[model samples]
Target: MAFVYDLCVVGAGMTGAAAAREASIIDNYKVCLVGPAEPKVRKVNTGKEVFGAHYDEARIASSTSSKVPVWGILAERSIRRYSELEHLSGVHFYDSVGSLTVGTRNSEYLNKVEKQANSQGYAHSMDILDSQQLRRKYPFFNFSSEDQGIAEENTAGIINPRKMVMAQISVASKNGCDVIRETVTGIVRQPDGNSRVVTENGRLIMTRKVLLATNVFTEIHNLLGDIRPLYVPMPQTVTLAEISPQDATRLRNMPSLKYRGYGEPSWPSDYLRNNNDQIDFYMLPPVRYPDGKYYIKLGHSDDILKGPLQVSEMQKWYCGEGDKALEEQMFRLLQRLLPGVTFLSHHGDACITMVTPNSQPYVDLVTPTVGVVMGDNGWAAKSSDEIGRIAARMIVQSDWSYDLPKHMFKLYTNVTGPPPASKL
Candidate 1:
């Protein structure tokens, strides 16, 4: 017997999972989710590929954006819907520990963050804290006297990204989505105008429409043939520090912290090759990992370089051993900032995310039969739910009546040259 679906969503990461789940809400449509299993090391190759993006335990979910107003709007929508999503999906994912965006007074980043909050009418969701107020609330931070912060009391916190994705896909499955754990190797358009997705094991899934939420892998695999590159895949490294129960208790009340680094330049251009000083970093509160140890996660915003870092394949870049000197620099900063905080050693891992020129995601139809929800730019977790909802509605309704502005996410085809031969 042949298999067919009304919609097929590729990539089971945050966007794909949520899209599949959202599309399956209606009983009339048949939706199938085609994605790869987690990538792993092996002596021989299997068809399965790991989604390195969502492998982490915690991701910052905040409505307060230091970058753009649209992001804050998207984040606020997603954060507001999280509870409803959890209730409907019957899976818990948000932590609601609150979050802080700390920066020096008159800092460019903080200015943008405050502007977004005020412009988006979400200023009530956060409290702007002067350096003294910030110190009073969170004394652990070693902020300069001129530092200021924004406290998202309820609308921000750390999220279990893996569980969030699982809950979404699980809900999709319950809602009648055909969940296939196989990888889609190729997509071909049929004479009848339907799209046929071919799996590595020779299984075929025919569908009227397709949503590619493959994130960095979208570019890595060139899944949309001849579709101009909408995003560039870049490698990001995260450092993890296993903490003791006592340390966790001490830091239990600490919100997820986004510090722009007060006294030094932490941006990518500051220290691309050198790692002697700490770069700007986002710090998550201690969360229990699969190993049963509580660990705090920190990731640097400084690009591995100032420009986009190209990744050729998904399997080639999964592990993030980290730059030792950089890790040491981070450790030094943590010690100076949070005195007496215990660390049970540390390690690093790398993940890839699609970064657009403007640091926004693309949520437009690439081809008539294909739509995309890629280019997360590292904010996919908090924005996944809303992004998925938008992508699904665009495909199913075939209309643009979304509540959020749809102009920024329109597809841009900049394929100036010939397409690469077969691989990303």
Candidate 2:
């Protein structure tokens, strides 16, 4: 039977949508997106609601906590792609300014920032400030630390992520592709290279190529194996709280930044981003609310709204009520750090983080018809676009531009060093 489309995408979230859009617009291939018919009633994940929380138990068992992520190197690549997106798709990227990485002098914790910056030659306005110098420059930083900070005044800032995703899809649809919403129920590989995607509604889509950009949802398709760094699927609360003009000014002077060393020697870290309307705080977990129910991005309750992160084996801890514990701890952490900042959320939701054993994502051809695109962490932001581009390149050539070691696909785990072809 003839395939109905050249390429079919599963899932309609940011990654899937972007991939579908790219194949159509960049590759000019006919495409269709399969998922829900409409924005169906989304159930919540109680585990994700755990506002700003972390777990000793979870971290103790984590495989990649004590070291700088090997995958962190991929960020420079994404930045390059973002620089090109405006010209490639007519999408303008607004620079959010640079990032401030805080820590004490002689501290190994803050070294990750230095290492990355030196290797990438990223142009940023930066400074190494003493405790007094740091305190005087930014009034909001009340914490005292013996360590110095490496401020990258250059290339760190925010890119309207939602806008980026939407623009890509818009470009794709305009380029002669169809986007569908249907829950894929089955798959049929025909005698030819084409495949048919069956939906819950008994509808089927046939295509010569299929791309799976369904982040943590890949668990549902039995498509992932025991990869490491072990991504945890938890709810992330991004509260866009309104800041007073005076308060906004104070925050603005501080700029967008990240803190690499504060807590554990090898435990997870936290970061912050200051924007026009609000600032965003990001961490692994220990989130909480005054009422005991976990809230993501500041909402009224404990219900976990189902999004991309799932509750399967690789992502099971967040499927149930894990958020309750995370939220409580997260609040305590925030209270210590932000002292007096009111806790109110405007856009909290759970997200899936693909952490591999070695800090790399699973971007390999699992089968001739299917390729997996899971980010351990780097792909969480800009790398996603590059990932889609990589997939399109693979499908079009039936060959990879970058060569992989013979064992890269054979290894059940991810590695950071000693592998040349493994570079992404």
> Which candidate wins on lDDT?
1
Candidate 1 regions exceeding 4 Å error are 39-50, 219-221, 264-279, 303-307, 416-424
The regions of model 2 sitting more than 4 angstroms off are: 1-3, 26-28, 36-41, 44-70, 83-95, 123-125, 221-246, 263-322, 340-349, 403-424
* Clash totals for all candidate models: 4, 54
Residues 1-424, candidate 1: write the lDDT tens digits: 4666899999888889989989999878999998875654421154345454787789999987766466777888888888877887788889889999987788777888888788888788788888789889997777778778889986688888888988898889889898888777888899988898988789988899999887766654457876766566666767788889888988888899887744432223433332433346788989988878998887777444333555544454564354566665565566555666878888776677777766777888766668988878888789889889999989887767787667677665575332243312
**Cα deviation in Å at residue 60, candidate 2?**
26
TM match of model 2 to true structure: 0.69
The prediction achieving the highest TM-score against the true structure is 1
Q: Can you write out model 2's per-residue Cα lDDT over 335-360, one digit (the tens) per residue? A: 55555445444232333454444445
TM-score of each prediction: 0.90, 0.69
Clashes of 2: 54
lDDT of 1 at 184: 78
- What's the distance in Å from true for residue 213, model 2? 1.1
